[model samples]
Target: MKACNERRVCVTGATGYIGSWLVRSLLQQGYHVHATARDPGKAQRMLSTIEGIDRLQIFRADLNEDRSFDEALKGCVGLFHVAALMEFGTSVQENDHVRRNILEPAVWGTRNLLQSCMRSGTVKRVVFTSSISTITAKDEKGDWKPVVDESSVTPASLVWKTKNPGWVYVLSKLVTEEEAFKFAKENGIDLVSIIPPTVAGSFLTPTVPSSLQVLLSPVTGDPKLYPVLVSVHSRLGSIALVHIEDICRAHIFLFETSRAAGRYLCSAGSCTLPQIMDIVSLELPNWISKSSKVEFNRSAPSIISSKRLLDLGYRFKYDAKDVIKESIQSSIGNGFLNSQVEFKV
Candidate 1:
């Protein structure tokens, strides 16, 4: 594989929570970044977050449009394909909506983007942001202890059969990732995948990302909104988590390291529902009226190994406590939470 032009790269979904932070980090490293978004006008507003706006270029592109990414991908040596649809609401008619909104965009969009990359010829390496859903999509039954790592994969049939909106989202990720790897292999493109669990951090956009919403559920008093969290807790006492900054660093590390190949599981640690609730109760006692103590299903698998990334000599900067604390502080600072709320810790 040819060496990437270290100075230039393209990041899809550049205005999203993780994408925006990745763009900023790339810019801070003195790289000229070409960012793609569905609405270029909306993306341009991100200039307020990063200092080197002059080095950033915004392109108008849609995931459904096959040729929309051509212009943005031109002359880019590295590509970070991070864009995907995030549908939150659940209704009786949500299955069709999920198929149209989440599945098509995630799978088809990845195909179209890789096609564009193959045509561009300038792209030597691609870093794809996948999810842990691809690993743990099996039905929650029996005493099953699955060894999860880069080799683990969720069955497509299981993802397709489930009516649960959360599982549907997982299905979307599973399909997209499988298709991406197949395409990359056929075309002889160097590809690396980052599979993260619940990503928690501050938001770059005005709205909060879905992952952060899980952490904010108790305080926001809308636990039903996070069905994924409920499902994960019911099965696996706690879920693996990683900070946004740490995930972004992993992306950069994988891209820059020649030996980096295959998928790497990115997680700082796991947090139980009670541990999270206790932190919330200690920090913002007046915010919620419910008891801080919550029971967890201890039998479910909660551990996610980051040994592959650790072998690369990369160290995580935040743990479960730091992730929750920093996320709450950021939410409060950004006015996502009530200003009157007090946080003692």
Candidate 2:
């Protein structure tokens, strides 16, 4: 892929958690940003606080609609496809709603956007934001493989067989990613996918992201979100995490690095439930107490290797503890957590 002289790029799903952060980072780095969102009003309101707001242009686009992203992709040499229909526990049974609403739209949206990319003669490289849900490898007997990496792929049939809404979302990611790779290969569009595990830390979105809700479930004791955390551990054997900043940086890094190709696993680190709880006790003592009722899965954690990204000389700015602290602090600052909670500092 050739690099463009002008620093202009388009980011879809620009109002979402990671997308919003990426827009800020790119603008800070002197890139003219064309950001796409469903509602231009919400996009303008959400992104109004960035320092380089004048350099950012908001375009209305729908992932489910063909050619919706064309206006945003114009004159941009790079595209970051960050939009997706994220649903968890939507319906008890995985039926047509799951397929029509969640799965098919994700795949179709990817195709439609890439087709627009192909038509936009200026687009040289595309960076796709993917999730860890696509990496839960299992054997024929339904046991997790010893280690999960970029090559690990979750079977669509297995996800469908469970009839779980979360797993159904997982299936959507897997299928969409597969479709993206295939289209990129056939169309000669240089593409790189950054697969991040549970993302945490400071967020730009007004409401707390779903990932944060699941991350802090131990403190909130939220019945709905706690099960999602349990499901992650039960499927992946460990809770892998990445700071929101690091994941966004990786997306920019891969997009700029001409040699970067294929899938890159972008987790900063993994921490057990006890380890996370210990950090909470030390950093935000009043948030979670010693007597907090919590149960953890005893499964041996599987390793997620980031050797490829590390080999590229990328360093993680925050470890697991730092990520946890930032997430808690952001939650408190944003009113997701009780503002009365005491901090160590």
Best candidate per lDDT, number? 2
lDDT of 1 at 279: 77
Q: What are the clash counts of all predictions, listed in order?
A: 0, 0
Residue-level lDDT for 246 in candidate 2: 92
Model number with the top TM-score: 2
Tens digit of lDDT per residue, candidate 2, span 1-345?
333436999999988899999999999999999999999899899999998988899999998888998888888999998987667756547378767877787888889999999887889899998898887745678776877788887777777777543777687788888999999999998999999889999998989888887888776777666777777766777678999989998999999888999999998877777777777777666554423465765444577778889998788998877888898889988987774343334
Note the residue pairs that clash in candidate 2. none
lDDT of 1 by residue, 28-145 (tens): 8888999999888888886555778889999998878978898888888999988865554555345677678767777788889999998887898999999876775233453433
- The TM-score, computed over Cα atoms with residue i paired to residue i, of candidate 2 is 0.92
Clashing pairs in 1: none
Error of 1 at 173 (Å): 0.6
Cα error of candidate 2 at position 219, Å: 1.1
Summing lDDT over every window of 10 consecutive residues in candidate 1, give the lowest-scoring window. Answer: 137-146
